[model samples]
Target: MIERLISLWPARTGAAPIVPERSVAGRTLLLLITIMSFLSAVTLGGVVLMQKSAIAWSADVGREVTIQLRPVEGEVMDSNLRSAVSLAESTPGVASARALSIEESQKLLEPWLGSGLDLTAIEIPRLVVVQLSDPAEADIEGLQRNLGAVKGASLDTHAAWRQQLNTMAGTIVFSGLMVLVLIGAATVLAIIFATRGAMATNREIVDVLHYIGASNRFIAGEFQGRFLSIGLQGGLLGAVMALVFFALIGTAAGSMLPSEAGAQVGVLFGRFALGWSGLFGILAVVPVIAALTAITSRTTVRRFLSETS
Candidate 1:
C-alpha cells in the first residue's frame, strides 16, 4: 500500500497537476506577526500613558502648598493659625490661603480612617492649603522664611512630589523604549528564520534557475519580492489593529475618569497623535528586515553551491 501511494505521488507528463509555487507568503506568517506586534504595541502604548497619568496626578495634587500650626503643644492653635493665614494672604505669589475646617480635616483622613470616627477629643493640627497663580513663580524659599515669622507654624510645598514625578516618568518612558527595541529585534529574527527555511525547501528549484542562466541578483530579487509582501501585510495589519484597540480602550476610560482627568486624557491623545514617524518606522523597518533576510539567505546558498560545484 505504501509503495502504491509513493508511485501515485509523482506528477504525470502531459497531464501533470500544476503545482502552485511553494511560497512563504499568505496569512500564516503575516497573521502571526500582525497579531503579536499589534498586541505588543498596544500594551506598550498603554504603559506609556499610565506613566504620564501617574506623574500628572502627582503634580496636580501637590501643586498647592500647606501650612501647619502647632501652638507649643499646649497653647491654642487657632491664634497661631490666624497669624499664618494673615501672613500668607499678604505674601507675594500667594493666590489664596484658607484655614481648614474641622469637617475638611476629617474629610482628608476619611480614606484611611472610618467615617464615624470621633474628632472632638483629638487635638488636630491646623492646616492652611495655599494655592498659587503660577507654581513656577512661587518663591518656595522665601515662603519658608515668611512662615518663620509666624509662631509655631511650618510650611510644606511638596518638595518630594517633584522628585517622585521625575522618577516615575523616567521609568515608564524607558520601559516603553525597551519594548519597542525588543519588538524590532524579534521581527528581524523571525524574518531571517522564515527566509532561511523557504530557501532550504526550494534548493532544487534554485539550482535549476542558476543552471538556466538566472543571475544571483535575479534570484535574490525574487525572494526579496515575496518577503516584502509578507512584511507589508503584517505591518499594515498590526498598525490598524493597534489603532482600533487604543481608540476603544481610551474611549471607555474617558467615560470612567473624572471630568478633569478625562479632559487631560483628551489633551494627551491630541498631543500624542500619530504622525509620519510611525508610518516611516513601519514602512522602512519591515522592508529592510525582509530584504536583509532575503539577501543573507541568497548569499549563503550561492556560496554553498559554488563550493560544491
Candidate 2:
C-alpha cells in the first residue's frame, strides 16, 4: 500500500486544493450551519429584548407605590382616600400622590369583572398612586407604618412583583445561554463528522501526501481553510435571514399598535427593538462560527492522521 500510494503521488505540488472545492456533503453542511446560526441569532436577540424590557418594567414599577383604601362600614371612602393621599404626599421622597376616582378604579377592574356591571354594589377598594422622587431614597417601611394607622389604608411597595420579574428575567437569560451552548456543541460535532468524511473521500490523496513527506499541519491547514470559508458563508446568510425576520415582526408589531392586542404586545416586547449592541452581538457570531469550524476541522484532521500513523 505504501509503495502504491507513493507511485500515485502527483509530480506537481499545490496544483489544486487537497479538499474538493465543492461537494454534496459540503452543501449539506453549509445548510446545517446556516440553520444553526439562524436559531442562535434569534435566541440571542430575544434574550436581549426580554432583558431590556424587564429592566424597564422593574424600574417603572419601582418608582411608584400604591395605597389602597378598602370600604369600612361606618368610615367615609372619600375621607379615607383624601387622608391617604395627604399622608403620602407629606412623606419624604414622595413626588406626588393622586387618588383615582371611582370611575377610574372601575375602569381598572372592567377587564376582570366585565363591563356594564354595577361596580357600586361590589364595595371595591379605591387606589391612590404615589410616585417617588427616587425609589432608592424612599422610606418604604416608615410609610407602611404610618399607613397602618389609617382606617382600611395599606401601602403596597410592589416589592414582591419586582422580585418576581427579576427572577423571571434571570431564568430566561439562563435558558438562552444553555440553548447557545447546545448549538455550539452540535456545530462542533457536525464539523468533526464532516472533516472525517472529507478525509475518507480523499484518502488516496492524503496517503500520497504523507508518503511524499507532507506534514500533518500542512494537510490540516487545507481542511481548516475550506471549512472556514463555508462557515463564514453560512453564518452571514443565516444572520441576514434572522435580521430580516426581526424586521418583519417589528413592522407587524408597529401596525398592530392601534389595536388592543398591539397594546399588550407593546407591553411585552417593547416594539421588539434590538438596540445597536444587540445588532453587533448578532454580527459577532459570524467570526465565532468561522473560528469554531476551523479549529474543529484542524483538530479532527490531526487526530485522524495520528490514529492512522
Candidate 3:
C-alpha cells in the first residue's frame, strides 16, 4: 500500500534525497501534518471571524442608546416619544434620535409574538434610538437623568449587553489560542518521532556519512530539508482544504439555514466572510508549519547523533 502511494508521486528527476522521501513513515507524517495544519487554519480563521464580529457588535451597540417610553396614566405615547427624541437630540455628544415606527416595533416583536397580532390592545412600550457621535464623549448619566424627567422614559446604554459580549469574545479567543498551542505541541512531537524513525531507517547511510567525516549539521540539514518539503506539501494542501471548507459553509449558510437561524448566524459571523486579514493568517500557517517541521527535524537529528556518538 505504501509503495503504491509512493508510486503516485511524480518520479524524482535526479539523485534521491539522503532521507528516503517515499516511505510509509514519511507519508504518514505528511498526512498527520496535513490534518494538524487544517485544524489550525480552521481554528485561526474562526477566531478571527468571531473577534471581528464581536468588535462590530460592540461598536454598533456603543454608538447607539435606546429610550423606552412606557404608558403612564393620561399620558400620550406620541408626546412622550417626541419629548424623548428632542431631549436625546439636544444632548451633548448625541448625533441624532428617532423613534421607531409602530410597524417596525411590531416586527421586532413578531419573532416572539406570532405575526398579525393586535399589538394595539396591549400596552406596548415605544422605543427611540439615540445615535451617539462618540461613546466616550456621551454623557450617559446626564442623558439618563434627563430621560428620567420624561413621563415613564428610561435610557439604556446597552452597557450590560456589551460587557457580556466582550466577555464571551475574550473566552472564545483564549480558547482558540489554547487549541492552537496544543496543535503546535502535537505537531512538534510528531515531527520529532518521524525524524527519529527516518534516521533509524537510514541508519546505514548515516553511519557511512559520518565515516566520511560529514558533520552533524550536514546530516541534520538533509533530514531537515526533506521534512520541510513534506511539511510544505501537507500545509498547502491542508490550507486549501480549509479554505474550501469555509467557502462551502459560507455558500450553504444562506440557502441551508432557516431564516431565524441564518439571521443569528449573520449576527455572529457576518455571512462567514473572512476578510483579507483572515486569508493572510491562514496562508501564513503553511510557512509556519514548514519552518516548525524543519526546526524540529534538525533538532531531533542532532540530539540523536549526539547520543549515538
Candidate 4:
C-alpha cells in the first residue's frame, strides 16, 4: 500500500521516501505552513517583548514623580525650586529629591530645538524629580498638596500616560493571540486538505488495502508521519527567520541611536538579546507544530476512510 505514494515523484523518490518528499502539492502545503509559522512566531515574539517593555515602563513610572515649578513673575523661581526640593526630601516615603541644573535642562531640550539656544530669553520652569520608596505606600495626594503650597509648583506622576501605555500593550498582546489562533486554524485546514487530497490521489491503493483488512489507523499513520516531519521543518525555519529579523533590527537601532539614547531605549524595549530561555521557548514551537500536523492529518484521513468504506 505504501508503494502507491512512492511514485508521487518518480524523479525525486523512487521508493525510499513514500509519504510526501516529492509531491508538488505536498511541497506547496509545506511552504504554506512555513509562512504561517513564520508570521505566528514573529507575532508571538513581539507580544513577549512588549510584555517585558510594559513591566519596565511600569517599574520606572511606579518609582518616581516630578514636581514642576512653573515660571511666575511674582514668585522667586530659585527659592520655589529650593523649597520644593527640601519639602520632598523631608517628607515621609520620599527616597530622594533633586532639581535639574539649567545646563541639564537645556540638554534635554537640545534634541528638539538643537544646541546654542538662548536660555535667558524664555522662562523655563525648574524640574525637581522625586523618587519614592514604594509607590504604593507613598502618600501621593498629601505630597501633591504640600508641593502645591509652594508658589508656582505643580505635581505630575504621569499615571495617565502609564495607564494608556499599559492598555496599548495589552491590546497588542490580545491582537497577537488572535492572529496566532487564526494561523493555527488555517494550518489545520491546510493539513486536512492535504491529507484528503493524498487519499484521493492514491484511492485505488487505499481501497485495495482496506478490502485486505487494513485498519483506519494503519492507513492514517503514514500520512501523519509525513505531515509531522513537514511541520517540524517549517517550524524550525520560522523560528530561525524570526530570530534573524530581531537581531537585524537590534543592530540597526544600535547603530542609528546615540549611546545615551540607545541605553534608554534598551531599558524601555530590552536589549533585543533574547537569552537561552527565549530561544528555548521559540524552538519549542517545532514539536508543537509537528504534533498539531500529525493529529490533524491522522483525524482527517481516518474520517475520510470511514466515509468511503
Candidate 5:
C-alpha cells in the first residue's frame, strides 16, 4: 500500500521505498505535529467567535439608549417618566421611547434579589428605553440635560461600554493571529528536524541504493511520500478534534448562560459553528500540510545528497 502511494508521485519504478516503518521517533513527531495543529485550529476558532461577538455588540450599541428616572422624596416618579418618554419621542432623531413598567423592572431584579424579596418595599429608579432613527443625528446631550429637570434622572447611551467591547475583541483577534504565526514557524522547524533525523538514520540504505545506480528523485520521493502522508493524517485528526471541542463548548455555555445575555452572546457566535467557510479552510489544511512536508523532505534530501557526493 505504501509502495503504491509513493509510486504515484514519481513515474520511475526502479528503486523501492527507502524510509523504514513508523519508528518511535517518527510517531512522536506525528503526535507533536497533531498537537500543534490542534492549537492552531483552536486559535482560528477563537478569532471567529470574537469577531461575531464584536459585530453583535456593535449592532446592539447602535440602536438604543436608556434613561433612568430616580425616585425622589414626594415627587411623582410615574409622571416624570411619562414626561421624559414624551420628550424623547417628540425629538427629531428619536424612533421610539417606551418606559418599562414597574413589574418588568422587578423581573430584572429577580436574578439578583431572588423571588422572595418584595421589590415594592424598596425605592428604585424607573427605566425608559429609547430607540434612535440615527445615533449620529441625535442630540444626546440635549436630551440628557432635558431629562435632568427631574432630580436624579440621567441618560446613559452606553457608548463607552460598546467601544470597550469592540476594542477588546479586536485585540483578541490580533493576539490570536500572532499565535498562529508562531505555530507556523514551529511547524517548519519541527519538519526540518524530522527530515534531518530520517536522512541520518537511513544513511546506509541511501548509499547502497546510490551504489546500485538509484536516482536522487527516487530516494527523495520515498521520504517525501512518507512525510506527506504523516502530515495529512495528523492535520485531519487535529482539525476534527478542534471542531468538536468548540461545538461542545458552545452548547455547554449556551445552556449555562442567562436567557437574555445568552441570546445576545449566542447571536455573535451562533452556537459555535465554523459554517461553510471554516469547513473549507479546515479541508484545505490537509493538502497544505502535506505539501509543506513534501517540500521540506525533498529539499533536505537533495542538499544532503549533494554534500556527501
Candidate 6:
C-alpha cells in the first residue's frame, strides 16, 4: 500500500540520487497538517480569549434590571411611574434606582428606533433602571413581589439572558479545547504515517546498514535526523501559511464588523504572534513526534527483517 503511494509520484522517487529523494508529496501533506494544526490552535485560543472578554463584559453590567410602568385603565400614568420609582428605592438589594428621563429613554431606544420616530407622541411605558449592589445578592422573586404591589409596574431582570450568555461561554470554551485536542491528534497521526511510509520505502537501505554492522541506535539516528528535518520544514512552512491565511481572514472580517468589533479581531490576530509558549510547544512537539516516528519505524523494520530472514 505504501509502495503504491510512493510509486504514484514517479518524479519524486525517480529523481537523481545526488539530488536526494525527499518525498515532496509526503512533505507537502505534512506541511498541510502542520499549518492546519497551528491555525486551529491560534483560532481556538482566540475563541477562549473572546469568551473571557464577553464574560467580563456581562459581569460588569449584568446587575441592572429595568422595571416598566404605565397607567392602567383608570389610574394616572405619572402617579404610577412615581410610585414605582419610590418602591424601587425602598426595595432591599437595590443599590440605586431612578426613573429614566424621557430624553434618556429616547437615547437608549434610538438605535432600534430611528431618529425620525417621535418617541414623545406615542404613549411609551415609563422605565426605571435599577442598579444592584451585588448582581446575585438581589432576591429577584422578592423584588418582583414588591414591584407587583405598585400599580402597573412590572419587574424585569436579565436573568434568562445571563443564563444564555453563560451557556454560550461554556460552549465556546469547550469548542476551543476540542480544537486543540484535534490539532494535537492530527499532528501525531501525520508524523506517524509519514515516518512509516518513509521507513518502508528505505527498507533496503536499512538492511544494508544492518549488514554493515550499524547498531540499531545509529540506524535509528539517521532516520531520526531525516524525520526531524522534515518536521522542522513542515512546521515553518505551516506557520507561514497560517499567518497569511489569518491576515486574509482578518481583512475580510474587519470590513464586515463595526469598528469596535473589528478592532477586537485585529487585537486577536496581533496576539497570534508566536509566543514563547507556542514556540517551545511547536519545537518540542515536532521533534518529539519525529523521534517517535523513527523509533517506531526502526523497531517495526527490525521485526520484519528478522521474520523474513
Compute each candidate's TM-score over C-alphas. 0.73, 0.92, 0.86, 0.83, 0.73, 0.65
Model 6 scores a TM of 0.65
When summed lDDT is taken over every stretch of 10 residues in candidate 3, the lowest stretch is 1-10
Ranked by lDDT, the better of candidates 1 and 5 is: 5
- Tens digits of per-residue lDDT, candidate 2, 1-309, equal 544554576667645458888887799889999999999899999998899899999999999999999888999988888888888988888999999988999999889989998877788999999999999888888888889878999888899999999999999999999999999999999999999999999998898788678789888988999999999998998899889988889899889557888888878988888899779978988998889989999999999999998
Which ranges in model 1 have alpha carbons more than 4 Å from their true place?
A: 1-26, 58-62, 254-309
Q: Rank the candidates by lDDT, best first.
A: 3, 2, 4, 5, 1, 6
Which has the greatest TM-score?
Answer: 2
The better candidate by lDDT, 2 or 6, is: 2
Each candidate's lDDT (Cα)? Answer: 0.65, 0.89, 0.91, 0.82, 0.80, 0.63
Better of 2 and 5 by lDDT: 2
Tell how far residue 118 is off in model 2, in angstroms.
0.8
Q: Candidate 5 overall Cα lDDT vs. reference?
A: 0.80
Report model 5's TM-score to 2 decimal places: 0.73
Error of 4 at 200 (Å): 1.7
Q: Compared with the true structure, what per-residue lDDT tens digits does model 3 show for residues 109-160?
A: 9989989898887778889999999899988888888887798998888999
Candidate 3 clash pair list: none
lDDT of 4: 0.82
lDDT of 5 by residue, 185-299 (tens): 8888898888888888889878866766677877888788888888888888888888888878888768988898788767767777677766666666667666777788788
